[model samples]
Target chain A: MGSLDTRRLIVCRHGERCDFCFSTHRFHWLDKAIDEAGRYQPFNLNLPRNLPKRRGGYDSFRHDTPLTEMGYLQAKLIGRAFRDREIKPHHVFVSPSLRCIQTAIGILKGMNENHTKLHIEPGLFEWMRFCRNVAPSWLTVDECLAAGYPVYQDYIPVVKETELNMNESLIDFYDRSHLVSKTLLSRYPTGNLLFVAHGATLDTCTRQLCGEAPRSNEEFFEIVQKTPYLSSIEARQTGAEQFEIIGTPVPPLAHSANAAYDSQYLTTPGYANNTDTL
Target chain B: MGSLDTRRLIVCRHGERCDFCFSTHRFHWLDKAIDEAGRYQPFNLNLPRNLPKRRGGYDSFRHDTPLTEMGYLQAKLIGRAFRDREIKPHHVFVSPSLRCIQTAIGILKGMNENHTKLHIEPGLFEWMRFCRNVAPSWLTVDECLAAGYPVYQDYIPVVKETELNMNESLIDFYDRSHLVSKTLLSRYPTGNLLFVAHGATLDTCTRQLCGEAPRSNEEFFEIVQKTPYLSSIEARQTGAEQFEIIGTPVPPLAHSANAAYDSQYLTTPGYANNTDTL
Candidate 1:
């Protein structure tokens, strides 16, 4: 007890996805403009807008599109925020999804080379999706935006259609998360740690850390936003078990008026200023 | 850039080492004592402690020891710290040294399971005498530690020894370090990045970032200490070159504190609180 310092842990969600495609999008306007221009756009041959219902209703879950450029930028912002906070972690564990991997890489770019070692753990991936899952006709992007929770009944059927799909239940994800966390906690007990995961997984972890399930979409958002770009949680040893809570989230930028600020549209100051004009 | 939020990057140092052997000490004193008392110590022969030396009787470099039990504990502490922080990086780059690898693994145990991809870049490895083509030496530990930094007068001779034993020089190391950093920055300009590097290599990057060489051991210590456990640096873009120095020397733990917290002599907090028993 005397040898180890008090420990801290923080869990955060990856940034937003395209409302329509669910892929990571980089340039909202470029995509919008491309869609409007309509002529000579890539994928026009395969995905014509005026196609009949059967063909036009392509199953998005079957596709593995890379994060949109904007999504990559969001990840970069997360990375930059971590850098600004001076949070040097001993290890970085991330989910294997392309978006998560990209996010992890962007964050690493913003950090010093001395402290971080990255590992890709399959167990930390998003809850598995069963095959041939489909979104119900009643599901709407607006509903999702307003509710901030996956309308599983509407989304599950559409997802089940994908090849190699594996659905991970909340219980399954929770169990896996607990196992992974426990293994790590038992092994390293104290140091800077980072985990890049999906929103659902983050939500599950949030519930575990907070001792209550998140009650609303806004609450989830608050939890994710409040989750530090880099933060800590104290781990206490009680009898045979160790207990810890996800600590407060730390934003990378300062809370001052001059500090970088952004909401949905504005990019963070550090990233915005340093962006390459490609 | 207008569409994305700012990102953060955090970088931190790995943990302690064995004072006597320079190996990573895995078992804290308490663990060791318990193992010894239980007669469950691993079967490891006490090999001879011969140090490498140059022609002029000055010690040559050597960096191939494994982590001692205490070193393992230090790595574990670092892992816990990372877990507490909830930092999830995208890419993890590591130097291929025994100590660093062990440290990386220990830290990974504390992080998310999704970070499974571990890349071993030879360039990220420590500056080694063996790598420079130097011949083997037969000296004692005291002789090696007492040997001052390589002198200019001994350059040719050392180079020749390096040729024979594959030992690397400071200049060779510097070039390698630069290449590693440059390559990564170019490849993942806007990604989260994490690197597990050697002490000398980390020092070199810090020096480059701060635009000054470490003038003294004290100065070096201060620089490293001030480094955030996890922090980001903006990628500098000079025409085709895209990288920035967002952070500086992420230090190892304090020397004095480390000295007082000797792994061999003290008990680990998790196992027991009795220093005497250890």
Candidate 2:
């Protein structure tokens, strides 16, 4: 019990997404997607209105989505919030994606620690579905390091075709999330750990912690209202085998300027201002 | 059945080990190690006699055990045999270990195809147990390319300490091996596949094909007599859900010169003869 209180987890969703993802907003099929019985099940193909079209015969940019400028600022605000509260984490973890990297970098800046060893966990990468597994020419570890991000020296992403499991489903992702949870417990044991990843990771990882997620539709929306834009949840290990979400999830609505902020719209400060040279 | 016959799996274990693994011969407990029931059960702590003593307080040599000269030669011989028999694999899969790399390289040389793109699959790495998880200085992917081996341009190893599941047991190893098998089937569903890895991989992967591994003491020895040295097994996917072990597992005794070979000893032609420099 004493040790459980010492170990805490800050499960966070990466800030707003690339223009590619945002332009294809939810009004097209989001309500329909939720209304369908498929939402209760896993891996049901819920095609949205604005699915990014393949750029060409072999367009890598069709995927490998990056965080928009607004997303960066949201991450920055979260990092600043931690700094403002004097919350010093023993380690910071992020997924191996451009968006997560930018968000982690922004958060790092907010924490005022440029050299914090940021671990790029491939397991935390956004769930692959509907052929979303095909990645673009990803930024290399050296590029991350050169770009002033302190990605761990040994960081490596899954690259080989054989390493990419094709039959991966939502269940598989959930299993991986369970694996990640076990890994966290075994490695950190006792420390303030920060995780910057995806919405699925948040749901799955938190489920592994407290054994359940926001089950009710209203509850799910309530917990995820600010996610993928600017949301964070705190899970405190209450026992060796138990965890309790301590702090409230600070979703985007609370951090953003006003209610006028379009909930469905992906607000960005524009790409020109954000130099994403890769 | 026709497709199954064409789509076969040739699972081969890496050959031999460096002086570090060899000098610590079984007078410390190799022979007796297998004799115990703990062997049948799994997770038996059988520390080798000469378990490479650290050269100093920090010695990376303790774990990144490379292959010896004989091991390389054995791999070359297997490659030559495959080439002689005209058994050309469309793709070559190998673990990202120095020994596996050396073996794969030696095999590539023997096959006379120096440019075959090798996929470094971390899923195929030697099983880890105890503190053996703490890796030694691993050879980088760039080093492989510099050494003239054609590694995939986008090969990346697994990262993140928490992503490394510490409580992994033999069951976990089997699960991973099963994942590797599934990956092999789904990725190249209709091609001849080759896996170059360790004995445990051979054991678990074969189990995925047919059914179980050898359980009896003698049967276990028979199945693994020459594994991790120079041995090969052929598995043909019989049905969508069935497989047949076609060719025999070519154990070392059948390949090595005479009965004079010491099977228990990690055979080497001396490090002076085998280059270890990356």
The C-alpha RMSD of each candidate to the native structure, in angstroms, is 19.8, 26.4
Q: Give me the chain B TM-score of candidate 2.
A: 0.69
Best by TM-score: 2
A170-268, model 1: which lDDT tens digit per residue?
A: 466566666665566556665655667665454454344434433344443443333322222223333235443423333221110001111101112
Q: Candidate 2, after superposition: displacement of residue B193 in Å?
A: 1.1
Give the share of true interchain contacts found in each model. 0.00, 0.00
Q: Can you write out model 2's per-residue Cα lDDT over B91-160, one digit (the tens) per residue?
A: 7788776667777877878789766888877777755563365743455567666656678868543332
Q: Show pairs that collide, candidate 2.
A: A226-A252, B24-B50, B26-B29, B28-B49
- Which residue runs does candidate 2 get wrong by more than 4 Å? A1-278, B20-22, B25-59, B130-133, B155-162, B213-228, B249-278
User: Taking the candidates one at a time, how many backbone clashes does each contain?
Assistant: 155, 4
Task: Give the range where candidate 1 chain B is weakest over 10 consecutive residues by summed lDDT.
Answer: B253-262
lDDT for each candidate structure: 0.39, 0.54
- Each candidate structure's TM-score, on Cα atoms with residue i matched to residue i, is 0.31, 0.38
